[model samples]
Target: MNTTPASSPPAPVAALVQMTSGIDPDANLAAIDRAMGEAAAGGASMAFLPEMSLLLDRDRARSAPHIAREADSPWPAALQALAQKHGLWLHSGSIPLLADDGERRVNRSHVIAADGSIRARYDKIHMFDVTLPSGENWTESSAYAGGEALTVVETPLGKMGLSVCYDLRFPELYRAMVDRGATLIAIPAAFTVSTGEAHWHVLMRARAIETGCHIVAAAQSGTHADGRETYGHSVAVDPWGIVLADAGCGAAAGDGGYRLSFAPVASAAVDRARQAIPLARSRANRRITL
Candidate 1:
């Protein structure tokens, strides 16, 4: 079922959905449903959404009860149905789900097949537990547990790597995925306004250039119900560090609300980038004898 880029089609298009989810799940799903339809209609074979697509409530105590379980959660089933309806691969950026202890939660990512089945799942590894320079305190570890394993899965777009918001800060994870033959990496993020403005584009470009893989990032933009603001520049970058598509500004800036940006995730670009850079292979051949 797994195939390399050489064996796949030439231009495999992907859609990145930029959203501003509130505390309400039903309303958010409605928005996503509409975006999925638009992506499919636009001829995208796959769609990627941002982290916390379901809910973003500031009160941890109030948000605890809303966490869903994959085994029984309607969100997965709903997403599966959406993928099946659109006949497209769907990558959910991240969701807060009940963890092993049933008390703690995990930031989980999902890859849905065209037939409405979950193909792969990845829990977020990094926890955003720092106090920002703006005096905004966040302790994600207090509410969510870190995932243990790296996730790379076969898709129509070639080998795909999965990660969440805070995980983007770590380059080693992307390098590891590249070593595993990943040609595309998806990072679903709910990056804060302060940090996103400072480091979002640079980090994304760096990852793509270093790995020679396309970076598809869907982001949460604008202010949310929790009074927290997000820098909303959901972008798609090619392997050569070029931004193929961007959401520009928020929905208020004349961009359609919950709009999906379509971009070409071509295998030829990956092939050319790897051939030109060869960094992945170069690292493997490096020798250091002690």
Candidate 2:
């Protein structure tokens, strides 16, 4: 009987891309191509992109044509080509696609292998339907349906959990992912300037610390053609909650501009963090009495 456990994969370098996407899908694809090329040249095994990586148009009337079914849309094929061209795996942040019902869209993420094949897909489970203190209202649920299942996939970097913007507020989702053996989690977002400045860093570090998993967040930055502003600061954090890299905000992430940052994803770091605290063991032993 073979009882030996599978060994963890070696660490791989990941590239985080912070972009300021507008309403144009073609331009966004070009930006991604440029970034992927740079990531490959810089020795990144995989590249992570921000949410709404393709089209960020909030105007339903204008974005309707672009938010077609995944099978029908050309964007996925285009992205596959880019991955194959760069010979790198790609974590497509999130794209809006028409749901099966055809009445609403779903915010979905794709994990593409180096061979240009899609290994996994995750739809954003949480909806951002808040009216910020700045009076900026966002009703994501109006246009998008929440996803039903959690997604964790194996990559050269490690077992990765996928989540999109607004999902960060839900801790249970991340805990569930950790229970499923995710050593790293991706939280690609298009955060508003106001809430982002308040909770982005704090929440990101908290997730990493609580799960003992590395957190890689690619973000959208600067003002967009739709008259909305996003918080930049694309960041990568280790399992110990240390920020490995952060692409800062403001002019450095101006509209139509993009920034790339790199971080090392190692199983050793996950091992050290989990072994130091052993939170999982403690949680399993505890009994919650209401």
lDDT of 1 by residue, 38-65 (tens): 8999999899999989887878888866
By TM-score, the best candidate is 2
Cα RMSD to the true fold for all candidates? 4.5, 4.4
Give each model's whole-structure lDDT: 0.88, 0.92
Tens-digit lDDT track for model 2 on 1-290?
99999987656899999998889999999989989998999999999999999988889999997889898899889999999999999999998899988889999999999999999999999999998899999999988999999999999899999999899999999999998999999999999999999999999999999999999999998888888899999999999999999998843534336798999998899999999999989887889953
In angstroms, what RMSD does candidate 2 have relative to the true structure? Answer: 4.4
Runs of candidate 2 exceeding 4 Å displacement: 1-10, 250-256
TM-score of 1: 0.93
Error of 1 at 175 (Å): 1.0
**Backbone clashes, each candidate:** 0, 0
